[model samples]
Target: MNLYSIAIQQLTRQHMATIEALVRQQPEFDRVEDLADRLRQAGVRAEARYVPAEKLFIAVYGDIAQVEAALETLCRLNRLNCVPGSSSWQLVHQDHSITQPAVLVIHL
Candidate 1:
């Protein structure tokens, strides 16, 4: 796990036992952060989170071409395995467990 994950866990375990943030399943967050990391490595600005939803989404603010490329990369890396969705951001999967979700805040 990354420092981000560890830190989040510690904070929640110590400070947020109740409902303070949206938690996700382990594999779900894993894939999300992994996708963010891969995108960063590819020089694409992106992240994964749910502002107030039930699933994670890769929030991107780059050129359309770059975003498309990043999405393609995610698919190739087996990250974006989202089923055919009826939402704005199709999720890789939906697991609403209470665990720290990987939220990559890529500061522009």
Candidate 2:
């Protein structure tokens, strides 16, 4: 009975978590699309986007273990030499900052 209860508790607490990392790359770097495609092929839903000179957000949403595994694969494939947990997210845009919708905002 004790073992069964423990197992149930563990199962109940299982939930999905998201892991994000800013892909800091230079103008010459152009592997965003390829990386996103590879991650999708590996069964991980990843979004690799470049918001201009700002940050390249790479977000993976899945189970904790799966996310960790995907993150590892991402690092291995991308050759990210930075330490883990070293990067943090920063808000590049705010709702009040821009009055126009993103579709209307055009960049040169």
Candidate 3:
């Protein structure tokens, strides 16, 4: 498997619970989830939820070229006017560091 696939595999099993917990804490994330579901209906296995420390993480598996398309669709569905920063990983383990994709991280 490639790096992206490996990263996603690790996250799906280990990080999804934390993500779900964080999502439950935010009302805005409910809308995000709804938008994610729509993306799923369109054949994108996209997952959107919050990681710890209040940062949102979106993971898209399959077709790297389609990743941005998924994100754009998400932005349109949520009516977000700006493109958030993209990141390669989900969670970061650092002290006093905002190194883990602070501005709406999207991964593929």
> Over the stretch 3-108, how does candidate 2's per-residue lDDT look in tens digits?
9999987766652211112223332134545555665777876666656465355555565456556556665665443234423222122344543212111111
Candidate that would win on lDDT: 3
Which pairs clash in model 3?
none
What's model 1's TM-score? 0.48
Q: Please list the C-alpha lDDT of all candidates, in the order they appear.
A: 0.56, 0.46, 0.57
lDDT by residue (29-53, candidate 1, tens digit) is 6767777778778887777665544
Q: Could you give candidate 3's per-residue lDDT for residues 1-108 as a string of tens digits? A: 899999999889778886677556576566456656766876778788665575565566787556666656655654443344444422222333433222343555
| Model 1 misplaced stretches (Cα beyond 4 Å) | 1-24, 79-108
Report residue 17 deviation for candidate 3 (angstroms): 20
Models 1 onward score TM values of: 0.48, 0.41, 0.46
True-vs-predicted CA distance for residue 103, candidate 2, Å: 26
The CA root-mean-square deviation of candidate 3, after full C-alpha superposition on the true structure, stands at 13.4
Residue 3, candidate 1: C-alpha displacement in angstroms: 42
Error of 1 at 88 (Å): 5.4
Query: Model 2: residues >4 Å from true position, as ranges?
Result: 1-29, 77-79, 86-108
Of 1 and 2, which scores higher on TM-score?
A: 1
